[model samples]
Target: MGLFVHGDVGTAASYEPPYTLSSGESVRGGERRLWDNGAACGRRYRLRCLSGSNRPCKDGTVDVTVVDYCRKSPCPSTILLSTSAFSAISKSPSAKINAEYIQ
Candidate 1:
């Protein structure tokens, strides 16, 4: 929910190539993907999109790895999702919908 893509960032700098997720799973640009919270790198979380005006995600939930910091002065939201992760869980990559998270 409230999803946005970070393809502009390219890849995460905290880890090496072949970025493996906390689930021990890998996807294209997995090493480069992440949830941009103020949390430390490699933190993991379970995210669920709550239905609302905009249908955020096709799937109810997904697990995400935090690989970078979202330090925008006027931040859009608390969580910033990678393009791949956002697409996996969201129906539309640009919609902002309600979301819940557990770490």
Candidate 2:
């Protein structure tokens, strides 16, 4: 299992402003609710919508619970993936992501 991050922005409850996270930021918050570097297959991440709104889960920040690894580009090191992480993030359904990892 590898740690995946967000790469792009989209239209979702988490994608709103104020809570929206820019690139190059860790996806961790309080204990128990944290983003790790390892996850299993067919897992689900309990994330918080960065936008923190009641809107639809189009795109936004999330707290992943580590499900499966993504076999895609710029994923292994991505800190903020595209809307695709919705599955892993448990907000949206699925997404086609392109993200950059934080150093």
Number of the top candidate by lDDT? 1
Which portions of model 1 miss their true places by more than 4 Å?
1-39
The residue-by-residue lDDT of candidate 1 on 1-103, one tens digit each, is 4453331222111122444455532222222223423334666666665553554547655667665544454444445665566555567666654555555
Query: Which pairs in model 1 have colliding backbones?
Result: 2-97, 19-31
Predicted structure 1: lDDT: 0.48
**lDDT to native, each model:** 0.48, 0.32
| lDDT score, candidate 2, position 54 | 36
Residue 68 shift from truth in candidate 1, angstroms: 1.3
For each candidate, what TM-score against the reference? 0.56, 0.24
